[model samples]
Target chain A: MSVRDENIIEVEGLTKAFGDFKAVNEISFVVKRGEIFGFLGANGAGKTTAMKMLIGISTPTSGKAKVAGFDVFTSAEDIKKNIGYMSQKFALYDDLTVRENITFFGGIYGLKRQQIKNKSNQLIEELGLEDVKNQLVGSLPLGWKQKISFSVAMLHEPKIVFLDEPTGGVDPITRRQFWEMIYKAADEGTTIFVTTHYMDEAEYCNRVSIMVNGKIEALDTPQKLKEQFKADNMNDVFLKLARG
Target chain B: MSISVRNISKSFKKVQALDQISFEVAQGELFGLIGPDGAGKTTLFRILTTLLVADEGSASVFGFDVIDGMNDIRNSVGYMPGKFSLYQDLTVEENLTFFATIFDTTVAENYHLIEDIYVQIEPFKNRRAGALSGGMKQKLALCCALIHQPKVLFLDEPTTGVDPVSRKEFWEMLKRLQQKGITILVSTPYMDEAALCDRIALIQDGKILDINSPEEIVAKHQHVIYDVKASNPHQLISLLKAYPTAHSVYPFGEYVHYTDQSGEFKQEDLHAYLAHNGLKEIVIQPTPATIEDAFMELAN
Candidate 1:
């Protein structure tokens, strides 16, 4: 199958349990390559648990899944190398300069030195960060740092990038700009697996899955989900599901 | 005024956290400080709560100067910082008791002050606070903040990362608190929450941009926002931005919110331009402006 038509991630009956409690239970979903998929839920709604399994960090108690065409059970290392991840709390190294951080991430992703240099320059230029390329990431503004962190996550040209509540607490303009970057990445055929608290952001995704308790309660286009739930917006839809 | 701030300024070494900013919150009013991170919301709150002193300007809470009458202010105000600050190892009830003791009171003395918020977490009283869910942690923190029945409350982004359901529920609690005549000075990055405030000061980059009722702010500066959609949103955004008359274009939800530089213009001219550029199913409808739109305009 062509990259556009193939599923970058396929999961069936994904379950993760700690003792007697099922954190993520019997969840099944397919993420097509280049699609912006929003995984949303309430705060303690097992998103982190499910995400850990998908990223190859935490082992699933029972399930069959493939991430970046690699089986989660046997090829966790391969899945790690083929996917990129960034979160609001943790992204680039704070003490590292913008250029150095890019080079570091690129090297970690197995890029050659020359390739790292080229990508660093292109990335800095794309973000218009040439002036502050040598400044420590710690000194930069939150929006600038967030944008740089996101671009750095894609430094290795990973097939998919997972963002966790990436836009929380950012200014309105910066949040939209961040989404624009996500849109550009998805357009370039990198599947974007993102989670956000902003309901409007859920609307930006091709498909959104709202998790209630430990199961996927609703998954569809924002419009269809709204219609199905008889809600006016994603906020109402989320409230209706999460409150239940 | 319940809270009064004038020409307040503070800096951390080289960074000016709060510029010469000023505003006032009347008694029993739900005042919101709406802005994103590093907009000086926390700095202002800290100064008012007597945790930090401003380099310039003066602030008074409940008629007590923040610089000189800190103890008086402390006794009259309740503050909940953005971060979860309750004693994690302590049980929910124990933490509430600790805060109440520190305030020279007992939970029973001000039980009614937090009765509405406390009952929600009473079932989990014996559970360690660290094990509580995010929503429950916020509720418990709120209860602690109100344990002493302070006349003024300062909540710094209490719902920053909370989900929609919890955020809604928290706001409802704030409304209830307000009805009880407790003046609140709350800060949040979420613009939608601005409407819940009686008046909001749209702040950014260490300065207050505008302070008004959320309704008047949106109602006055709407300037005819247009909701534009096309076959390809990415291309549509770029094209609209390149249009000579485009004032601002930002993707809201499923559509791009566009405004003309001139505010009012011919709709056909733009429709013809998009259609000529191979765009299909073009939909351009006027939509009401929101706090986000007003912020973008003023911030832009």
Candidate 2:
């Protein structure tokens, strides 16, 4: 392993154009291993478009990138197998039972039958879903469903996990618990990449990059960003950058 | 009073959405209704706007009863629901004009009222409402709501999905509107936004946890909260939870918000315990509480 291997994600001059519009205009960034990297942006600031490119789902018009040791352009399939993704819409099967949902996701990750059984039991126990394990996911509260969905996303033990606004509508208490899980994942050396509109969540990241008008406007730790912008919080810093 | 509610209560088939919730909004005040997803905010807004009748209790808008004075309230109040409700096929200008006509007025009559917000989206007037971005759609919805020159505006989560910049701009527009003496009542799940309102009512599980200005609410917290961080953040939470003096320990951003049962808690003792537990890079600092802390404390 070389110095570059220490970086879980590396991008330089990444650009994605739609006709005449540059959704992601020549952005560059790096994500160190075992760190929580927050990609912050206002809606329509090209955050999602950039994230899609990083996740290997969308292609960049011009760029150099590597995710989890795989080139994005040629090795997207290999990249997909090494990362987990959870979106705000929640990819869980609503009609499936909590236990069934876990098993189903594990199967998709190509886990063996015995491995799926062990992982499902462990996940259910960790989330305190013993009683509701057989209950349909739709019957659970929004918070519980969100936690379970996040856990399911991590079942395959991917090297990195990408969360898109995971706690958007969740209550503060539940959101706190979700962050606890995220911290646990990071502690275990799984690099975490997340995008959120919530500034408070942005503060939790080790490093954050803010996008404005389809370009990387600022990137630094939350504390430094606040100090550099002469602002009190990420919200104020974001406002200053966006207004500029 | 701009708005008043007396023992307002509503229930669905199985859930009691609001239970004896009562609050008053003073004239020209920017009041915030803060809560989570199932906090009954929408139900309250619906009742106040005369779109739904409360099972038990009454609400009044600008000295008019919501039940008997439905038409009067409808004419004087502007309501922007949680979801965007506009003619998707119609252009931005058409939506504004259509809403203005419904109130028996023209855009020119109230052009000054929405001028600050309208100008931002004026360049896209020819664009269909459906083609606008999230921020643009928000401005368009707000313009349509205000085209009628309502005395009181009821906005339900106006900036929920919008970006930080657009959210800031929207709040600035609200301040301008409030300066013109329009009492605004807004609801949002984001607790950080509570500070922007003149006063806020923190609602949870269909009950108002506490109603007061954001600063006052934070001042009311008797315990001194400490922000605790360590190399192993998760383990730190568990260790702090097991500590005898710990009153409440919850994950807050990059640190765990730890409050002790004993008024005089020792940081040295916490540091010793965390170190003994094999945690590294421990940093403990006293931090001022925010509206979020107050909400968690009250809800508990």
Candidate 3:
């Protein structure tokens, strides 16, 4: 999949409101293809709301967003076909074995039987899931389940991937490994858009957009944000923007 | 040993949770068991607290074997689970009293130890624990754990879902507890938190990776670190990856943290390279490595 340098995801004055409350204000940003852009915010921040609009699952109250070269409002079905999503709550059948979960997700993505088998093998080997390949997902630890969920998200080889709090409760070591897989995918030309409460994880994005209340407070690299805010870590930078 | 494990292992259903993991936490030391979820942090904590029996191995707390001296271990240890396990229907005061009763102690006996944290939630002592805010719940949980004044404290991701400010506050509390001669073993998935501990043991996939202090880990980082920022940050990241000297370029907030293949590349060389690549408004600064950076280096 080839995408121009201009923008793979374009948002113009996007807005989403729930009754009198504006969940996402008039925010606009362009995400280039093959970049890992992070959405940063506190719990009540509008990051998730904005993502819902961009992914075509929730309709925007006004303005516009173009994802995968298709309008979010009119071409939502087409947009869904070109992107993969992994929610904070990973959608997987816990009762199924590792192999069965992979096959099921692959089929959902419309992969052929032989292609699913081939991809499953590569995934199992890359993730080192060989020992527990036949074990039920419910029996696996939280870290292993997280890795499996990520692999399943990329099974269909979509042009872009979206991850929501993909490493919330896992150990730091597993988080580091999860990011390696993310970098590998980015290297292979898959654009990654992720949201996270962990500021350090935000630092791992190609560029991050920080939300406060309902507006994009800051959009830059973790280093620049730290310097501009005169802070040592991403946590400080986030506190400066969010708390202020 | 204040805490000891020999060939300790556990599994939920068919998943091999812990594979003969054994370690010791000395008296009055701040020890960190660092790993993501399912790294057996919970399972190990349960075993040491005598809440769950390991299918294999033997663990002893304060020289009292876990299997044989379970009651003694329970009476002498403070345990705070990842999730707030206190009764939701009970008030803060009730929860504290309930836990104290289990260990044959009273809140009045250890009131001084928990006075600082308890005072913050004292007004809400009458409110049900479920109605308390996240930070408040954390404070209440901590107070209950400390009420008994156990020799060793087992905190399982105590700061997991709490706010950053509260997390910082919680660590400060732990440091204070350490000063009072309490041996603490805390687990967390946040790399930054690992630095606050005296020494950390990085665990993953049921295996121990490395054990060292935060400063030692960062000092051992063998890479020359550079932070790069530009007007068009995302575009700069894409450009940096294709640059000839680029070894690894990952986005770090508004700038990209990069390293070179030789670990000896100069800043002037980087500026020249960026200019030649049509990257403008660039800021390249050499920065000190953090524990998270060192953790990433070792993890890879």
Candidate 4:
């Protein structure tokens, strides 16, 4: 398939249920390759549940999804192999040196030792972490750790990346630099799917989907969505949808 | 009914947390302390609430000095720290009653004060405080804080991780509380939230940068900001930054907020320059300053 024609993720009527309670109710959307798609919702709005299903970590009770051109249910392992994941919580080992953490994650992704060494060098220079390469991951500042976490996630060169609130506590300047990194990744044909409570970050996405009461309430470009809701910003757009 | 801080400074060993910070909260006024993390907001809140003594200077709540009137201040102030401090093992009702008993009052006595918030959480009164959702937990905490009907409320980043809906509802609750003559001093890292308060103090590096109403702060922005969008926003930022006339170029949402060294910037010149530089799908327009813009100006 051509890069432009490929949809990295395609979901139709995706639903997850625990007994009678539907955590994610009949959500459908398509994410194009190299696009930054934002999944947004209030706390307990089933965003996590839906995301778990898409990432092949949780089973869906009904409907269908295709991630990285593989069925979410039957090809879960293949899907996992082709995608990277990062969450608000730092996933790196705090006790390990920066180089050690990168090498370990690279090994988990089945990269060769030579490839790991080369990638580590490139990442260290790109992130300006050459001085801290030998320092323990825990001792670095939060902003540096966040940037490193993101770099490590992209080390394996996955087709798509999933970021769950990657900049929760980061300062504005750090957040801007983080977005630039995301843009660079997207530019390199890595589809980006992220979830965040920050409305400003939501505005940065190519398209955003807002969930309410376990269902997709609205999905569109930020500008179009704002115009549709007659709201000044994404926050107001979210408030109008969530309150309804 | 009011809070006054005069030259309050605190240090932790070698690191200075707060430096000569001074502000006044009028009776029943909703004041906001706005800044990023490690900006001395929590330190100031601690001193004002009588939880910690400043290394230097004086603070008073309701005309009572923090050092000498700790008991009086404790009696008349409601403090909700950034972290949820309620008993996780206790049920919602149990926690409320516990706080009431400690304050030498029953929930019934101040039922009127917490009715609006209480009724929302009443359905889940049997649930443990830990089991409640973030929004519900916030409401329950506020209810417990108000059980004694304190004259002043200090909320430290109360809506930090909350969703937009819950944040709006929480602000509405604060407005209601203000109507009941309760002075509120709230601190948050969210710049957009600064607008919700009656007055805001922008703080950074252990100092107050500016204090004014949100409108006044925005109005005081001297630069003419233009929201610029191009095919590639990241490249656009770098391009604008390298431009000789560009003063400040920062990424704001989807667009790059650009300001020129000169107040009088022409859109045609920018358009021609971008076109000459082989940029496409460019959109540039002047946008009104927001609380975040004002905060960014002061922060720099």
Candidate 5:
């Protein structure tokens, strides 16, 4: 791989303005391939706005970024095709059966009918959902739904996947199980850009960036951040930064 | 007693949301219900607040039976549902006034009860409740809940999605309210917050796992936890779980928390075993068990 191809996501002086207020003010970072990058910030902090721009759903006010080697400005359509996105608020359809939801998402991602069938079978087998593949998603427990939603997000095997608090309000055992899946994915060379409220989960990332009031105040690995801030854990580091 | 429940069970269709749940809260106590999603926390809250009836057993709030004296309980207790229950279209001040008037009272009558919490949102008094930020919305909802100055307060997952800083501040406010002698029954998915309550009841699948102070619950955990770290975390977890004497292996932050099946297990033996597997820099340190660990153990 060339030097440029190693970097899955690249941004420089990225900023987004809503009226007179700048939601994201000149933030820049690079996410390497197969690296688990955690985007940490308080509520109302520009994380979501910045993420929308990178996913090619929202336009930026200024600056530049390249996602999967395509410019977010001119080649947003290409960027969309090369990325997979899933959020806790809006994931799979609850009214649809597990198999139908997988087929629907695969179709939307432009997969062939034969390929969708194969993908559905593989996913159901991996998730141990063969018994309930025909059941409505609403009938399953919260933990099962979360795991199934994650597998569906990887249906197209995009270059980068974005997860927004994929384990909110889930059981502790299931939450850890979800992280295990994340580790396996990263090992297979899929860059992960995720956000979460749990600080311990932040420590699992290869590198984390804490945004305070629209600026990246601190960016480093969890161990280095803890040492630099002279704190015991990521939660304390966050308290010190966001409180300021 | 501030609250009491005896064999309370409620089911929704085929799913047994709450099964034979029973507990009691003392007067002026800060009691917490710690559980994750689909654990029937919300359904129990509804039953205690007199919004829904239980299929079996009986409950009471301040000596008032939940069913026989529903009106009396509703008049003297405050409830904040898991979801944002305030009027989104109304301004913060308007929402507060509306709640106060519903109980045949005014904000001024209970000004002292909520002065500290209300002041934080007063600056945004005219802003629509929907326009406020997430943290600000939580503060406003809290103020509305306390405007009636009830003897007992029920908060359902008030800080579930809130940031750490805001969550800390919100708990401090609750502490102050406790000092004012208002009994609080709160619920949360975050285990860290459970330690702040005077007593916590760990509930799952509509049954109580244990009810006691957070310290007592952690003390009851039988396993001696060790924070184990190695060069390769993925391999370390699998190896630890593969150990014949290993009781539990969980990925916690930078280290994988491991426990042995026997209390007499030695750390050096485990360290040497990992060293033999081509694992280097293997460090194992004993760590104190937390309520989260106890909850998981009890649930298992």
Candidate 6:
């Protein structure tokens, strides 16, 4: 059943502060259901901070955020249950086998024994990981490990998946394959919200929000933003916006 | 040829690091080894520079075998790793001077070669390498790598983590370096960076997919390309993928780059279909293919 609610995430004047530094300042936007939203910024931009708020890990100092139809402050537990998060360096036990990692994460998400087994098998098979299912995660190649991490994040089947620089340090082919998996999930009606430093990856998002300093300077589809900025590509658009 | 490799392969604890990866660099050419992490890019670089050994194959720098003439290869090739691998504890000048001393040379010996980049970070020569900003660290690393007047340079993703502006500056520096007849073999994950190289080898999972100039790669993609945009791009991508004639549909910036299975499918069909499906503000325009388009086509 399609949720009639237009907004999966609603942020209103959200602010995140760390002592004297306001890492995020009054940022607000709505991420609709099943939309692939790209959050772009330089190294220290408030992208991470703002995402942290939406995911309910970091409390906003003021304003309001309703994610997965749960209030960020009061319904954090509900929000957590409705979301899956994958950081740049995803939390995968390197010493564990691929199957073991899948099981562990699935267990944590409160899946039953048969459900975890069935889902793990399905994920491993879909990703063509059957050959390496017994291999230690640390022993697997970077690209394979990234795919496994992403699969593990979705093991619980959350309504929204948040990936923060999931493609960093990997090669182009692996990135392409990783994006294919993301598209597959979105096709299944899972909202994908991700932050990336790569401009090309930003282009893959349905919509992108470019953050500068502590505020979002531009927000639109990659083509609109590129044309409005008079830039040939997202990289040039980002440079013109952020550097200015 | 400035650099050549013969049947070079490496393995790390049962993992095939590089499988007979062989390529050569012409003098003054900017060659790029484009791949993801662990595509054996760094491993290949280490072997070429004699920093690591290869189980099979051989490589040479300016006619000197890397294994047999390790010292000579080290003396003639400048290498910058993906990470800033310089001494983090030492000051910028100290690190440069230390590298110079190890090579039995001095910064003054090749001051002209590195003058442009070194000048930017010269004021911070006394500051610790660990304390320097990302861009400053990059410049310092470049200065140290070029201080010995090497004939060839190997940069393994030097622009990976640096900001876009800094990355642009770094590429400009490489262009200037190339102008002086230095053969550069740089590895990067960014496809856009491949355009900066005279030629590039696209690698995936220890296998070389395609090797050619960036323009040539794009030229090889024979497809009727259409860039389609609508009020709801996500919905549009799904709709496009579901279309019976859709050969491939992938997100391209704000629009979707789509190719049809049938040789001749018109944009009017797409517009009418999208409008019927409740998509609004639709615009379907033809666009020239890019390196990414070619890459995606090959991948599928």
What DockQ, between 0 and 1, does each candidate earn? 0.70, 0.52, 0.24, 0.48, 0.63, 0.35
lDDT (tens digit, per residue) of candidate 6 on A30-135: 8888888898887567787888888888889988999999999999888999999997565699999999999999989999999999998899899998898998
Cα RMSD of all models vs. native, in order, equals 1.5, 2.7, 5.6, 2.7, 1.8, 3.9
lDDT of 6 by residue, B178-218 (tens): 99889999988777778888998877656677889999988
Off by over 4 Å in 1: A1-3
User: Which of the predicted structures, 1 or 4, would earn the higher DockQ when compared with the native?
Assistant: 1
Each prediction's total of clashing residue pairs, residues at least 3 apart in sequence or on different chains, is 0, 0, 13, 0, 0, 2
| Tens digit per residue, CA lDDT, model 1, B208-246 | 999999998898794789999888787888899989999
Q: What residue pairs clash in candidate 4, if any at all? A: none
Q: Once superposed on the true structure, which residue ranges of model 2 sit more than 4 Å away at CA?
A: A1-5, A230-232, B229-235, B275-283
Q: Sorted by lDDT, highest first, which candidate order results?
A: 1, 5, 2, 4, 6, 3
Residue B233, model 5, lDDT: 77
Residue B199 alpha-carbon offset, candidate 3, angstroms: 2.7
Candidate 3 C-alpha lDDT tens digits along B1-300: 798888898887767778888888889999998776767788889999999999999999999999899989988989999888999999999999999888788999999888888998999889999987777998999998998989999999898755466677789899999999999999987777888888888776666777788788788888888889776555566777887878767665445778888656788887887788777888999778876666666666
Judge the docking of candidate 6 as incorrect, acceptable, medium or high: acceptable
- Comparing 3 with 6 on TM-score, the higher-scoring candidate is 6
**TM-score of every prediction relative to native:** 0.98, 0.92, 0.73, 0.91, 0.97, 0.84
Q: How does candidate 3 score on lDDT?
A: 0.83
- Model 1 CAPRI rating: medium
CAPRI verdict on model 3?
acceptable
All candidates in order of DockQ, best leading = 1, 5, 2, 4, 6, 3
What is the Cα-based lDDT of residue B255 in candidate 1? 84
Candidates ranked by TM-score, best first?
1, 5, 2, 4, 6, 3
State the lDDT of candidate 2 residue by residue for A126-159, as single tens digits: 9999999998887676778889988988999999
Report residue A83 deviation for candidate 5 (angstroms): 1.6
